[model samples]
Target chain A: MDEVKIIEIKKSVFADNVKDADALRAELKEKKVFLLNLMSSPGSGKTTTLIQLINRIKDKTRISVMEADIDSDVDAVKIKESTGVSSIQLHTGGMCHLDAEMTRQGLDNLDLEETDLVILENVGNLVCPAEFDTGATCNAMILSVPEGDDKPLKYPLMFTVCDLVIINKMDVVPYFDFDLERCKKYIHLRNPQAQIIPISAKTGFGLDHLADWLLKQLP
Target chain B: MHELGIVFYIIRDVKKVAEENRVERVSEVVMDIGEVSTVVPHLLTHCWRWAADKEELLKGSELKCNIIPAVTWCDDCKQEYETVKHGKTCPHCHSENTWLLRGNEVEIRELVVSG
Candidate 1:
C-alpha cells in the first residue's frame, strides 16, 4: 500500500493568467499596438458601435478587429464589410471567455506591424470575461438602455473591471424607462472612476465623444 | 459553463505540480473557495469529475472545496461584517465606502497524492 502525502500549494487560479496578461501588455507596448477589450451582453449593439467608431477613426489609425465567440463569424465579416478594416474571427471552441493566452494566439494571427489599434470584441458575456484579463490596454463595456440602470449593481465585477462604460441605444431611451442619471449613479457606485458615454450607434449621437475617448487612449 | 473553464485551469495546475513532485497519481485536490468568488461549488465539482477523468494523473481523484466566509471592512466604522448578508454596504455604519476584506478567492490550497 502506498502512503499518502499532502503537498502544500496555495495559489490563486487567476495568478498565472494575470502574469500572462501583464507580459502581453508589455509586449503590446513595445510593439506600439493598443488593444482594447470590449465586453457586453448579447445584442448590446457592440458590433454596431464598433462599426461606427472604426469608420470615424480608420483613416488616421491602422485598426483591426478580433471577434471572439462560442461559434460565429458574423461579426468578423460585418466589421470587414462595413468598416473595411482587417478583421479576424476567433472561435473559443465553446468556451465562455477568452483568456490572455487565447488573446495572444488571436494577436499572432493578425498583421501586428500594420495594425495600430486591435479591438477585441470579447464573447457576449458579462461574468466570465470579467474574471479573466484578455491582455487589453483598456477594458470597455456596453449597457444598452433596454438592459436597465441596475446592471452595474447586478454585475458589480463587470463594472469594476471596465475603464469605460458606453450606454448605447440612447436614441430609444425615451421609449424605455431608462433613467440616464440613475444609470450613471449605479455605474459610479460600482466604479467611481469609470467614464460613462451615452451614445446611439443608430443615430450617431455622442459617438464622436466615444471615438475621442478611444483615440485619446492610444499613443 | 465558466465552472468547466475553471476545471481546466485546475487540471493544468495539478498536472504541473504532479510532474514537479514526481507523483504518479493524485488522490485529492483541495480548494479554498470564497463565498463571493462567484464560482458555484457543485457545478465546479461536477465539471471536475468529467474533466479530471480524462487525465491520467487526476483519474478517480476527489475534489474537496473549503468554503471561506466572505467578510467586508468599513473604513468609516472601522469594523467588519458578513459580506453575503450585507453586500457592499456596511450594516452597522450603513456606509457604501466599505470594501471586501476577504472572501473573493478561488485557490488551490493543497494536493493529497500517493508517495
Candidate 2:
C-alpha cells in the first residue's frame, strides 16, 4: 500500500484573493486609475444611476465603465450610448460575483492610460459580491426604497463592506414606507463611517452629491 | 453557484501546495467551515466533485468539511453564547452589544496525499 501523509496547510480561501486584490490596487495606483466597484440588488436602478452620474462627471474627468453580469451586453451598450464613454461587458459565466483576477481581466480589456476612473458595476448580488474584493479603489452600493430600510440589518456583510450607500428611489418615498432616518441608522449600525447619499435616479435628484463623491475619490 | 467559485479557489491553492511539496496526487482535502461563513458544506462538496474531477491532482480526492460552531461575545455581560441561537443579542443579559468571536472561517486545514 502507498504511504499516506497529511500535510498541514491552514489558510483561508480568501487569502489569495486578498493578496491579488492588494497587488491590483497597487498597480492601479501606479497607473493613476481610480476603480470604483458598484454593487446592489437587481432592479435597484444601478444602470440608470450610473448613466446619470457618469453623464454628470464625464466632462470633468475621463471615465469608462465595465458592466459585469451573468450574461448580457445590454448594460454596456446602454452606458456607451447614454454617456458616450467607452464601456465593456463582462460575463461571469454563471458566477455570482467577480473576484480580483476577473476584475483585472476586465481592466486589461480597457484603455486605462486614457481613463481617470473606471466604474465596475458588479453582478447584481448583495451576498457573493461582498465576499470577494475586486481590487477597486473604493466600494459602493445602492439600496433602493422599495427594497426596504431593513436591508442593512439583513445583509450585514454587504453594509459593512461598502464605503458609500446610495439610497435610490427617494422620489417614491411618499408612496413607500421607507424611513430615511431609520435606514441611515441601520446602515450606521453595520458601518458607522459609511457615507449615505439619498438620491432619486428617476428624477436625477441628489446626483450632484454622488458625482462629487466620485470626483473626490479619483486618484 | 457561490460554492463553485470557492471550489475553484480551493483547487488553485491545493495545486500550489502540491507543487511546492513535489506531491503528484492529492487524496483528501480537509476544510474548516464556520457555521455563519455563508458557505453550505454540502454545496461545497457537490461543487468540489465537479471541479476537482477536472483537475489532475485533485481528481478522485475527497473534500471534507469540519464545521466550527458560531459563538458570540457580549461586551456588556462579558459572556459567550451560541450565535445561531441568540444572534446579535446576548441571551444571558439581553444586551445588543455583541459580536462574533469565531465561526466565520472558510479555511483549508490540511491535504492528504499518497506517497
The best candidate in terms of TM-score? 1
After aligning candidate 1 to the native by TM-score, how far in Å is the CA of B108 from where it should be?
0.2
lDDT of 1 by residue, A110-201 (tens): 99999899999999998999999989999999999999988998999999999999999999987898999999998998899999999999
lDDT of each: 0.94, 0.94
> DockQ winner among the candidates?
1
Q: Write the per-residue lDDT of candidate 2 for residues A1-219, one digit (tens) a residue.
A: 877899999999999999999999999999999999999999999999999998899999999899999998999999999989999999999999999999999999999889999999999999999999999999999999999999998889899999999999999999988999999989987888999999998998999999998898787
Residue A17 lDDT, candidate 1, scale 0-100 = 95
Docking class for model 2 is medium
Per-residue lDDT over B21-82 for candidate 1, one digit per residue giving the tens place of the 0 to 100 score: 99998999999999999999999999999999999898999999999999999999999999
Supply DockQ values for each candidate. 0.86, 0.79
Worst 10 residues of 2 chain A by lDDT: A210-219
Clashing pairs in 1: none
